[model samples]
Target: MVMIHIPTHPLVHYPGDILAWIAASLAGWWQHRAFPRETERLAQVTPPGYYVALALGGVVGAWLAGSLNTVPSGLAPSHSIAGALAGAIVGVEGWKWLHGVRGSTGGAFVLPVAVGIMVGRWGCLFAGLADQTYGVPTDLPWGVDLGDGIPRHPVEIYESLSMALFLLAYVPARLRGRAWARDHGFHAFVIVYGAQRFLWEFLKPYPKLIGPFNLFHLICGGLIAYGFVWWRNGGVRADHGAQGSALSVSQPDDEPVRNLP
Candidate 1:
């Protein structure tokens, strides 16, 4: 047997892992836009507040999930948290400026962010820190052995799956002009991601003592509760007319609703 050694040093491997995956995912997302069917419709679709909310939520969620916890498990430490926040703030504004205050999904904002996460988490998994740690141990064949005296759940995989499913749900609903598609899609993403994250946190090991629960769990639970309340309040769709109807961002008088059915 040729003696084969897995690289024991994390520093040697992490940068490439994160950089490559992130770069590739971004490239793929951008490339997908090149296809007219996938790219053109988004142009007309003005970015609603949901985009802004998700970006802000991601920053706050990522930060609280990473920093307030007993230890870091994902990409970027408190510093990454700062960077993520700054990037989101700047990115949204910059997007507004570039695309005009009337923003459109026609660009590469949403997909790339999700893709970047998918890539970045891989980095965390390899680096073996940050939000990468979590989930109950499983005897399933796919379980990862972190060599810390236990076979752990691969929480990152769970997140990646969640985001992927969200994107998948969003794209179709967005295109067909589903009723409350944008609103439900965006808010649901937040609520679902938050809830799943909270549940997953239960399995991971944290440094601080929080009576069997962590900060992320509480926050997620809160968001999920809010999501439920939010949905009950007629959801994002209630604010608008039915599907295929023009959404009057301004006062209804401005749009001149003609014989609304």
Candidate 2:
């Protein structure tokens, strides 16, 4: 069994970050083109220092989650994508609340985030065991030998594929101008992505924080809950608006539609 070795080169260590930056830029471009008005509104509502807070939160979250998975005895700690995502979400949401911003400004990020993850996972895959992003042992024909003699499930690849499929489905809806898709795109992405993560987490070898579940499982659950609640509330509001419109149409013919002089 040939075990994959961690690259000793400093430049090689940051490929994931580099790819993620590129993905972010692409996501931004797409968001600007697809939802210029919403994007502008978000800029207006975003408070000062929001980006700084998000960066700090991501660092802290990555450290905390990474530590939970594997903490070196004396060496600097590692980070986890899951931790970074959760931290970033918390940071952005906290900022939004402080600024009294309502609804999902995150809709614009869904595509970019998905694309970034799909590209970034390749970095983890190539990082070998040092990245701690590997999956459980597997005998499947498609299993990867990540420098290790043992063929593993390649969970990162699975996650990337899942997100890719989501984007495929989502892009069409956005193009078709579906009301729910336009309004609650972020919520839909979160719910779908959370479900995908929750399932894939089961295949990972991370230590369980609860019975048969790890820290990521809890985070996925929270994401799913947030998405579901927002989706349901949006639906209810739409339904009520439709009913009100119907009621207005049913008004007596004698009654004027407007009060004119």
Considering only N, C-alpha and C atoms within 3 Å, which residue pairs clash in candidate 2?
A: 1-149, 3-147, 4-147
RMSD of each: 7.5, 8.0
- Candidates' lDDT values, in order? 0.50, 0.70
Model 1, 170-220: lDDT tens per residue? 667656755444434434554666666667677666553467776666666
lDDT of 1 at 231: 46
Once model 2 is optimally superposed onto the true structure by TM-score, how far is the C-alpha of residue 173 displaced, in angstroms? 1.0
* Candidate with best lDDT: 2
lDDT of 2 by residue, 1-261 (tens): 333333322344378779877996887797688767756655554546768777888888988978876664333467876677778878977875675444555666777788888888777777777667778887777777766578788787898899899888888887786655666777888888889989989988877888999888988898899888866654222233411111011223532121000
Q: Output the number of the TM-score-best candidate.
A: 2
For model 2, state the Cα shift of residue 87 in Å.
1.8
lDDT of candidate 1? 0.50
